[model samples]
Target: MKSSDKRKKRLPKPLLSDMEEIEMDVLSLEEKISYISESLFNTDDLKIRELTFNNKKMVILFIDSVIDNRNLQLNVIKPIIEKSAGDIQNVVNSNNVKETVYLDEALCAMVDGHCLLLMEDSDVLTYICIPKVMRDRSEPINEKVIRGSHQSFTENITENIHLIRERISTPMLTVKYSSLGKTSKTKYAVVYLSHLTNPEIVKTIEERISYINVDSVQSPGYFEEFLEDSSFSPFPQYINTERPDRVAGNLMEGRVALVMEGSPTVLLLPVTFFSFFQSTEDYNNRSLIGSFIRFIRLISFIATLCLPAFYIAVISYNYEIIPVEIIFSIKSSLEYVPFPPLIEAAIMQFTLELLREAAVRLPNPVAQTIGVVGGLVIGTAVVEANLVSNTMLIVVAITAISSFVIPSNEMSTSVRILGFPLMILAALFGVFGIVIGLMFLLIHMVNLKSLGHNYLYPLAPLDLNALKDTFVRLPIWLMKERTKDLKPQYMWKMTNPRGWKKNEESK
Candidate 1:
């Protein structure tokens, strides 16, 4: 048998992912091309060009889909062909060029827009590639803010990193690249403040991402399910936001952010339950106004979860607790309805949800029309038909508005879903059932862990120092240290810059 034939016979029959090694000396140029072609399942877009220069045979291989043809010709082929007698590294003008003996690395590089260079009678293959950077500066549709930076994260990972880097220009700001999903081979980056973040926390998050053994990862949602400590908890363990300013703020507070390619939403981990209620607008406004807004949001959280249930409890079993006139009004509204309070509330709640969903799935202008027209027409028609009571409609409308007050959409949805069980409880045993449900909720939150940190941190564990910024937004100068629960490398974030105030008073 010929030497080339023997090398071909030794090639593995496994998939491309499993074929990690390729001995450059054992495989001739033709055999290497054939091996890669077969490993890639003989895809149609794979381009293989064979050229000869200085009496040496060479093959330039890359997928036509991802690589830029102009770059490959001008930076790689033109240089190599123009100067055929020297090392390819010094000759090629590509920004990121590397040489490796492993076929797996070459395959991955090709998928990521890098072209592979193969030569006969050599034990090393060269890589010629240019980084692709895309810029998108549109404001986020969901996380819009009135003050502060208007820029949001983009689908491109490089641009997302640039957004955060410009905000936090420090040597300690570190970003590490990784690949996930066996088939998709999607790229992701782990960003954190190396000096502020706990080393163990960073290591744990990276390991969890690496251990995700799946065929494909579509979004950060997939990773969240695998990374969260309590999968079934009602509260969100991570905050997903598209605003780069928000991400920069969290990183400054010693949190790790996961930025996935092709996704504008970045995942921030080890978050507290209170984190969902906080927003970038809070920091932009005056301290007192920000604190008041946060207070209202917290009240809304409670109202969203317990308002309907409270109404159900009062009408079903605790009517004596209400004023006589209000009770008469509520009682009269219920008289025309055939179902009980719980049933009446459920109908309106489901109807409101349908409207909300319709409004979301439709276009912006159409969604607004549907939301207003559909809600008013349906609400008025249901009340007039005696299918639902006016009192129940009012309660449901308030509940929906309260749910929308939540800054994080994930937490808002969870809070809305939680209301159903509470309503059911109120129907079963009235006020006692609501109390029991709330007790269980408190228990679950107390026990839940977000990447091993207390989900209710600074509240359940009672950290007095961290509380300076938890329930309320204090003046920026007042928060002298990072949250103690995170155990950040640098506990003191700042000293008293306002110490000069005392000198002014003395003068």
Candidate 2:
């Protein structure tokens, strides 16, 4: 038999199923094209257009729903057929064009909206970049701020990078792209400032991303789970945000951000427990006002986590802690409640959570209606029915509102969920149980790490300098250096804006 015939005979019979193991050199053009078609077997939108180029057979493959047809017609087909360009490199007008001899690599490129060009009797396949459809950038729907850039990230990774680049146009900004998911081949970018960011942190993040071996990474949340220090913890180790300005701000602080394709949420790493409480609005407002609001958010954090438990302790075992008049008022309200304080608080809190979830899944107008109607109707019904006490309702309502004040939704939800365990503790051992639960929580947080950095920085290790910006938003000029916990290469953000005073004294 001829050598060519022997090579064709060696090719795998189940081409699509065994394509990963099949060598590109052993397959003929006919077999390769057949394999491509069979691999995308059930996809009806897969388009394979065969045409003549330089009087030779050529084929282009792409998904009809994703590729820009205009570019394919004008830039690709027009140049190849009319200009008689011999190679795809000379014809296609794409920013990214690559030749791949591996079927797996070619398949990935084609799936990511790249047009694949295959020529007769050629072992190489060329991939032409054709941009996919993406939503326009708009103001963040969830992470809105009173003052800051209105732009948020979109589903497109390139567009998100463009938004970041527009803000930080320096050469120090570095973006590295990688593909995750063996089957899905989801693309993501790791961005950081080369000079300002710690090299070891960048290396650690890159290494962790490289080690993420999974069948699919659907979103930044999925990726974060794989990289997180503790999977079982309810608290989020990384801060996830939709606002580009937030990501940019974090990046400027020597932190790294993970931007995934097809996901609007970006993950900011090496974040602290206090970081979730801080908002872009804090910087937008004046120092005194910002500090006041920051203090309120911190107070809300404690209230969300401990308020229900504290109430359970007070009403069940420590009623003496209440003032004389307050005790009478509470006693009067609880006289009608048939259940124990624990059960009453649990019932009210669960109802609040149900209403919250329902409102989120409904339309805006309908959601608003549900929030107002659900609160009034449920609160009144429960209290009148003696299913819960008025005091319990107020406690649950206050806890819910406090949780909502947290800037990070993930942290807020975690805080709300945490109340359940604390309530259980408070019921079992009263105030003592609450104190023990809190101590355990504090220990866990101190031990937790975000990207190998402490999760409760400045507070756990006790860095007084960093503490200046943690609970309170000090004046920007006072914060002359970045957080030392992050170990940034360059710590000083500013020298002194009021340097004229020092010069005057010297003269």
Candidate 3:
């Protein structure tokens, strides 16, 4: 055989063969019970009760932790015992009642919080839904807004869907469900508007998700990492949010949302770099104020990415660029420090990151205390000990605050991480190195894709119509079309939302 053929033969198979198909068995009641007990290793929580009704032996099986005891008693047991019905399905007041002869299917239903009923001399088994636990729908703690609905998504997928359905209330909205994770069987939903969303984008998302070969999907983060277009890029191609209003807004704009059963965070797909800086509160406020805040966010993005590098360049090799008065003060402060500009910046930035992580991990009250006290104590001690210059301290402080200005925490973290490389380049080649680093960064972003769509849309692709809503919030009437980059099915959102002005002018 050729060497290439040998290499091809060494590759692993494409599909998993771990989950074997089990055939259904036509067994007696005692044999069925024995099979379930053996399959589950006779666990303690697997409660199987035998009851006599109309000279028939009926068996009930369920896991204690996931079942509603009262419902099982009143709906299934009470009706069967009191009514003495031949058909147990008629007496049960449950919505999800089904008959199956497969032991694997019956076991799967019982594991999913359903109660199973088997009668002697009968070839069928019945299962009813009796799930007991659910989390309460509460306001999002992370993505709070001053002027919007307070509700957020919960761990329950059905409740999360209800939250979105309540907001949109349109027949065009559709949700498709599928299971992921071979071992966990984690369920997730792909939701979008059938008439508004691009069909190609939906198909791509579905295919990517369907092809994920994993043993478990513990959270939405797993899906985000697996479904993203580029794994090497630091930037997050998909936007994850806990706010239902934000998901609803994106759905209306012809984007797809992935909501998982066990995760509160919903993933919004085909997002651009600019999408991370947007806030739902932007549209909640006046257009002018919203535009101003967005502009500040954009400035913060630049400052967070380049401030440390710019500081390093100026202090290390381009002191001439700084004003004479400011340069004297900076020089005087640095004269007492023993480390080079690069070392000082690295030390201070690392310390700032440590404090940030510490504050996040601590309790709210303790975190507030640590944030204020730790910064004051550590910053003062370092400066007084001549470890870092005061100017570098101020630069690091400003850079840290600018990173926090970003609306998305994941993007904020990526921006902060991107600064480290830029600072290193600045140390090596001064301003020239900074420029080269920025060029490489720009090239990477230009080439990146979010679900096969440009990552730097409206800026790289140069869509003038979309620019109105990119860096600034134009009046609602002015943004008459959806984002052109997504290739939405319906482009014109409103022909003329401000048509009243034309009538008034003509009169």
Candidate 4:
């Protein structure tokens, strides 16, 4: 059998080191091309070929789909195929090849999705670029916008990076790629503005990522384990966003962004509680409308947790607080109910949660059907069955809706889980139990720190200046300070762009 045919029979070694010895054994250019082609063919869609120029033979190889076909046809294949001699001068000018003996420099062209052509006696390789397959369009699940770009991120990491780069074309934007997951070998990149981001924070993040030893790092969330200060805490240390605008805004604010392979979400480091509540929609709309919606979100948060417990405690134990007419109406509502206050409330909460879980798991059309039917049937049947008081049912329904008001799903889940403890305490010790539980929760929040920054910043640490942007996002111009409570050494951000503006005449 021919050497080329024999080489094609064997599989390519997975490691780069194995290829070096094999390359030496394959004396002929055809044998080398055959070996490389055979090795990587099954794993990747590789294009391989052998070219003859005068007496010298050159082998060319590349991942076919990854490179731009036009560039390869016009710049590489045509030049080599049309050449008539071993005259290095003619090949160099005709092919636009910069080097005749540097293999590493020639291979650098492959990083841009190009293929390389290697010759006998010549160290240089010809690089042919081509295009790659792309995933079909899918609506963005995380960064949904009613107005603005409809294009969402894909599972492909390169495609996601392309989407980001297309938006921010600034020269200062930088991307540093790294690998995690010892076995999975998942690729991820740290993107930030070199001039805008803090050097200390970047160094800290890079150092932390380098030490990560895991089975696999598939998503941005998986990388969080290395970056986060407190894992056991309920709060998320990194802000996961899908919107390029939000990532760009955060990058401009001295924060670094992480994009991992297969994960559509971008992770922003050193995030705050105030940031978790913010949605891109808030900024997309008018400032007045945005502030109004934010205020409602804050109100809903307070209501979702404490409202149901307060209602139960007030009606069952603190009847004196209710007016005579209101007390009579409440008593009448519970008259037909057979279950006690606590049991009735539990039944309602449990039923609502079950319905919610079912709706989420089912198909959208079916989920909507289930929601409508479940609400009508359960609400009427429970009341008619004398299972729960009408007033308590209304309170439970309102509380459930309020929980959804939280912008972050993690925060919403935390709020729901935390509610049960408050509800149990309210049932056992009237209003006093609620107060004690709340006091404990307050202490936990105050003590909680995400990435060494207080979770309840400006509220617990008492940074009065930070408050203007915390509970309320003061107008851009009025905000004149940085959130440097983390004692960040590089405390320079264009926080108040207009503050330092000199008079027009001074310019």
Candidate 5:
């Protein structure tokens, strides 16, 4: 055989039969995709269909209900089958006349709520975009708001994108598409403004995502696990929000958003400590009310964290610091109690925890019933038994209520859990122990970084501009610049809400 002929021909193995011979050659796209889909999407629910259009074969694959099949039939199937003789003849006359063509682009377009058209003898597939009718609904439960827009993200990526696009209409708003999950090949998008977003942040995020190797990722939880800067920290680095307005506001402020398919919650990067205490209602109200509410929440946060520990320390070791009347009152209250103050505090704390857990496990009505019954039964029983004093009950109740004052559920839970440790320390070493715990907390928080940005920004790093909006929302007119730490190109989003002429007229 000639050299070219020999290179094309494969040598036969003596032990293997012709039927079992392995071919060392490049596989077609269809064959490769067939192998991958069969191996990866090996489930009863997964649907894959091969249909012919104008004598050209194309494969349609998607998870059921994840796509609207009715729309696909009308837009894609009808378009190809109803084509006249001229259209069929044109593709046949063109280059690369194969009887069947696989259009990957068309498949991707269809995945994004479009219909794909694969023609015979054509490498290019046409994407006939179809507008999917999504079920209009209120905002997601976890992210519900009393004052903001109620449109929540859907399972549909297209609808989610539409929600974001509607809020941020600027051309600078950009979306970069990518896929993860080696087996599922689920599509995800990293959205941010080009001019406003820091290039280094984008690069770091892209690199982190590109390196993810997993079988399948179901929701934002998987993405969070993959992208979190520190796995050990109780404090969340990425802010997860289901509200589009929140996401839009962050994007405008120069933060990036990672939106995944099949997940309503979007992951926000570079969050600071103060952001946790904020709610969407903060901005919707008047400045005076907003600032007051913000201040109250900050105070509540500190109170919740330190109250139990401080109380424990005062009664256990710092009784000398207490006033004579208060000391006499506290002593009288503890006289009937059998246990020490620490033991009493522990009993009350554990009882409250058990009640909270039981309530959460029950249904809404049942949970309410459980809370009332548990509270009444436990509170009465404890005081009657003299295991914990009535005064201690009030303090524990106030502490629990204060914990809930934090708007973010995750932060509240962390604070609740962390309180136990501080309470223990205070009981052992008194006021000095509480101070030590606070110092440690401050150091840890100041050293923390969320996606490479300081977690305690505007306070630890001390940015005057960011402080205007962090602890308090200054009036729109008084605030001219976007957050400086965000590195936004347009520092001045709007010149004072009151125009220059209005200011002059007032003067």
Candidate 6:
């Protein structure tokens, strides 16, 4: 051969043989191992354990990184070696065991936390399910609870499902798992109480999930955006929570939760505008106290979104509406400020947002220090320099505080952003602009749907019966029905919960 032809002949051949192209089962154990090793590019984590069962050679193949070695030995290896001479079916004690002759199937099994067994003179390959390494559950920092269970969902999908099952403890609770993402192949589960959740809603959730086509889905956010009915709406279509207790509670009331592998945050779907206002503390507190807190939260939500705009409107065009005592106090505060009310309020609000963002980015103790010190320094300096009004600073502080009062971070952020447009509108047309802006917002919400369910729920649809649990939560016994907005299969979740009390009264 010529020098050029000799080099081409000496070059390495492709790793995959013609058998793979033909999709034929390779019966030889050594060839199968070679195929897999080459298929994975001879990865460092590939492990092989060889043993003799009654003098018959057997090999175990797995990835060291994906599986728990101790679990594999205790649950699989012990049973097989100790119970030799019997069929593999009777010897292994693993949860799932399957035999396959196809190399592709065996490779997939190995990657999914399974150990493949190949015995001498046997063409069939057996795969046993092995425990996968997973992280332990910890309380979510963002959604803390004072009185309820502190456990939150972990990145492990199975453990998250187990937590929900432990709380509900009923066969009616259903979980359906489906793999998503073409490259990532992320696993996700849809959980709901079958007897309570509407089948149509479940179908809708599934259909929406099926529509997502992506290489990777890293968190619940990807699924949320794909599944949402309105992508442009500022309101979140799902309640993203990590607390298992909170998810269990929502499931009991006939909502669906999407749990994704490798993500701790679970998505509670078809939630309403009011649903964002609820907190886990609401149910833990006494009924009257919870109701008062809910009312305050709703009020604070309004103030968070409209306080700055309202302030701008009053000083710019509706100072006539101000009380005689308060008008002088406000006018005196604004006397030295050179900027218009709009510019002053905007600057203060922007500065507050910067401080808030800094607090989130810094370490906990440092963040607290910066928040307090920064606010005092900025507030004092701005007022003394006649750059911003004292009254405007107060409005910005109240607005920031009110935004924090919102339990859901998504809604809190959206409200903060929506304030700017309302501010512009108010500056242009004053109180009428605020009313007109609010009217358009209401109309949009009324038209918005979350997975085909009303976004504003009982308020927009005016379902009087469901209002009992909307603005204020009634006592557990009195609030027997599930919210109509969810369209739960069973409306009355409780009946005669107080029958014993009624019986005592009769006695």
Q: Which regions in candidate 5 have their CA more than 4 angstroms from the true location?
A: 1-133, 500-507
Worst 10-residue lDDT window, candidate 3: 6-15
Q: Go through the candidates in order and give the C-alpha RMSD of each one to the true structure.
A: 12.0, 12.9, 14.1, 11.7, 13.5, 14.3
Tens digit per residue, CA lDDT, model 2, 23-87: 32356667877777655442334578888887788888875545677888888888887777566
Global Cα lDDT for candidate 1:
0.82
Off by over 4 Å in 4: 1-137, 480-482, 486-507
TM-score of each: 0.75, 0.74, 0.74, 0.71, 0.73, 0.75
Q: Judged by TM-score, which candidate is best? A: 6
| Per-residue lDDT over 134-212 for candidate 6, one digit per residue giving the tens place of the 0 to 100 score | 4565877888777878888888777777677667644355677788989989998888876678889999988778788
- Candidate 3 per-residue lDDT, tens place, 165-243, comes to 6666433556777889889999888888776899899899988887899899999899888988899898999999999
Off by over 4 Å in 6: 1-77, 84-135, 502-507
**Residue 488 C-alpha lDDT in model 4:** 39
Candidate 1 lDDT, 1-507, residue by residue in tens: 233432212233222223333444466677778877765555444689887655789889976645667778889888878888677778788657787766656766665667898887764778877533334488888877788788888887767776776676433466677889999999888888776788889989978877789998889998899999988887889999999999999998899999999998999988999999899999999999999999999999999999999999999998899899999998888888999999998888898889889888999999999999999999999999998999889989999999888889999999999999999999999999999999999999999999999999889899898887777889989988889888898787676658776547554
State the lDDT at 336 in candidate 4.
80
Cα deviation of 464, candidate 2, in Å: 0.9
Q: Rate the local accuracy (lDDT) of all candidates.
A: 0.82, 0.81, 0.83, 0.68, 0.70, 0.81
TM-score, cand. 1 vs. native:
0.75
Local error of candidate 4 at residue 417 (angstroms) = 0.8
Candidate 1 wrongly placed segments (more than 4 Å): 1-135, 502-507
Candidate 6: residue 327 Cα off by (Å):
1.4
Tell me how far the alpha carbon of residue 150 in candidate 2 is from the true structure, in angstroms, after superposition.
Answer: 1.6
How does model 2 fare in lDDT? 0.81
